[model samples]
Target chain A: GESVGLHLPTLSVQEGDNSIINCAYSNSASDYFIWYKQESGKGPQFIIDIRSNMDKRQGQRVTVLLNKTVKHLSLQIAATQPGDSAVYFCAERGAGAQKLVFGQGTRLTINP
Target chain B: NAGVTQTPKFRILKIGQSMTLQCAQDMNHNYMYWYRQDPGMGLKLIYYSVGAGITDKGEVPNGYNVSRSTTEDFPLRLELAAPSQTSVYFCASSRGQPISYEQYFGPGTRLTVT
Candidate 1:
């Protein structure tokens, strides 16, 4: 059975600070990992992704770190802002798999 | 380009009723998928199509059916709505294998069965 899980269900961060959301995946064969941001009543939007071959990948203001050794994944938001307030989800795809296994999202709240 | 569009933004159906959730994508993507999102839960794949005239069952395909007549359209059908079928349905598309390509999701259709 393949499973993706988040470390925290909710995270509150002050504006301008940094936020780190952790995820754990069970499948060792999974090579592709993605982080998505879902706003209220909207579909999940792609944020960033890291392949198992890469340890780190960065986007505009977000970074995705993949630790294949521990089967852990994480998304870091630098200078978090109010607009970053949304539910974040981590998804993983095993080799030759057609679908992604999503983790229960973590609600990110940006506090003033 | 309307990347992906799903009709009937919201719908309320009675038990035993039937309906189709229409999905269309203009990206010319070869792979399309149907997923359901329960409250406080993650998305579960119900069905997927690799290309036109080709469809396959996903992790949660029960109580639903799908058709891919064209590369741009994939519709999900519920033979008989049930209370457990009440959830947000999303349609997604990707150019190729998900292992390398990212999926683009639609706004989603909120279906409630009473």
Candidate 2:
């Protein structure tokens, strides 16, 4: 089955440093991608999203970069804080599909 | 707005038991979804509803069922629960087309099957 996967299962970063998480997807028909953050005992929270037509999108403190040619995506967080530590996941939506497929996820740990 | 709300934050069900996980969103969104998260893994979609009375299966829809009777409620039903079914369940809703991809999630229901 075609699925989305992360480059690393866990990432350790120091406070105030920038962090990047990478994901690879096999579905070329996907036209939309999204990033989500999930904390302990909570559901996934929406972070940012990008369309296949555009290569990059930015939020307040987060940025999502999409590479359609390589079927890859990345989420970058600037000036990582303790609150930014959580499990991050990348999801993709196939064309005309109502459900989004999710990647394995990367646990981002911030050391203060 | 409460955004999305789910009942029974935690539960322990014995084998062969059955239960329905309730999910309701006050946003009145047109789309709803159900997903399960296992330990150290990402979410697997169980089922999804495009709108009231329209439902469809997702990546992993076995051992689960869902129905959308109203615009705000989408409940997931599990019959003859098994140990493998022990996981955290989440309900989410979105307002726009699939391209929008902005989903609001509920707190989640944690279930343990013995």
| Residue A46, model 2, lDDT | 92
Local accuracy of candidate 2 as per-residue lDDT tens digits, B75-104: 999999999999999999999683355899
Chain A TM-score from candidate 2 = 0.98
User: CA lDDT, every prediction?
Assistant: 0.95, 0.93
Off by over 4 Å in 2: none
Candidate 2 residue-wise lDDT, A1-112, digit = tens: 5689999999999999999999999999999999999999899999998989999999998999999999999999999999998999999988887778899999999999
Taken in order, the candidates have interface RMSDs of 0.8, 0.8
In candidate 1, how many clashes are counted?
0
DockQ of each: 0.84, 0.88
DockQ of 1: 0.84
Query: Residue B97: error of model 2 in Å?
Result: 1.0
lDDT of 1 at A13: 99
